[model samples]
Target: MEIPNRGKNIMKTLCLAIVLGGLALSSALQAQPSEDTVSVPVSARQLRIDLPDAYSKMWPEDYRDLVANYSLSNGQTLSIISRGTNMYALVDQGPPHKIVSTSRNNYVALDRQLKMEIVLGGDQGASGSVTMVVPSRSLSDGRFVPEQVVLLAFR
Candidate 1:
């Protein structure tokens, strides 16, 4: 009789452990990023850049952390947040514009009312990475037509 009771107790304990384990797994799965969380589709792709004649060495080196490369699919106003590396003149347009550090993490508006919030994989890797920001709105916009991020490394 005692042996049978012991076997029953062991089975009950095993069942409880299994049930608790499954509950924990379910909670973890729900905590993960939802499908709505947006992320850039490309990090390995390069960007096309057109620098004006006024590129200064101080410009690229000083603002290395915030500097980025960008391309325009349509001929429209490209608004970039004022950063140290933002120094660049328009191809036929004019000179580079560098603004205060206040704009460091702000929006850089590009064509089609599309805006960019700078993307550097990590703070440490930003200097070397050819990071750029594109407005989430333009992700599905019809104006820009490029198979992939265009590679335009003028540096």
Candidate 2:
């Protein structure tokens, strides 16, 4: 009958439409970048430094161990702690990165595994404010060259 044929055609068309829609959705998802591949904006919460308790435990009497505290733009905190000749950048309660180099008011810390360097610099004597520079590349041809740099100021 004509009615039966019409119903069959409508069902087939619906099935094809569903299949095509699914394929389109799958392709769109595949085209999107993964979380790891996506780069975080500079305004995001980049610097998270946490103060360590061991430093305090080591020298319970010396309250001067906490060198300075900085407030990031994203409402996060960064702390610089010193223990004798060694200095550390305590980030988000994460493992401390030793302050490798320093020049005047600038302090440089390197995370070799991440291939990134964090530089903190300020004009005043650890009082006014600090500028944090995160560079994605290391030194090239004996000079520090960065492919991408993110600058965050501490207030």
For lDDT, the strongest prediction is 2
Which pairs clash (backbone N, Cα, C closer than 3 Å) in model 2?
48-91, 48-92, 49-90, 49-91, 49-92, 50-90
Candidate 1, overall lDDT? 0.34
Q: After superposition, how far is residue 128 of candidate 2 from its true place, in Å?
A: 7.2
Q: Taking the tens digit of each residue's C-alpha lDDT, what string does model 1 give over 40-76?
A: 3354232433333342343555555544443332222
The true-versus-predicted C-alpha distance at residue 143 of model 1, in Å, is 23
Error of 1 at 15 (Å): 68
Clashes of each: 1, 6
Which stretches in model 1 have alpha-carbon errors above 4 Å? 1-62, 73-93, 107-116, 122-155
What lDDT would each prediction earn against the true structure?
Answer: 0.34, 0.43
Off by over 4 Å in 2: 1-66, 112-149
Candidate 1 displacement at residue 25 in angstroms: 52
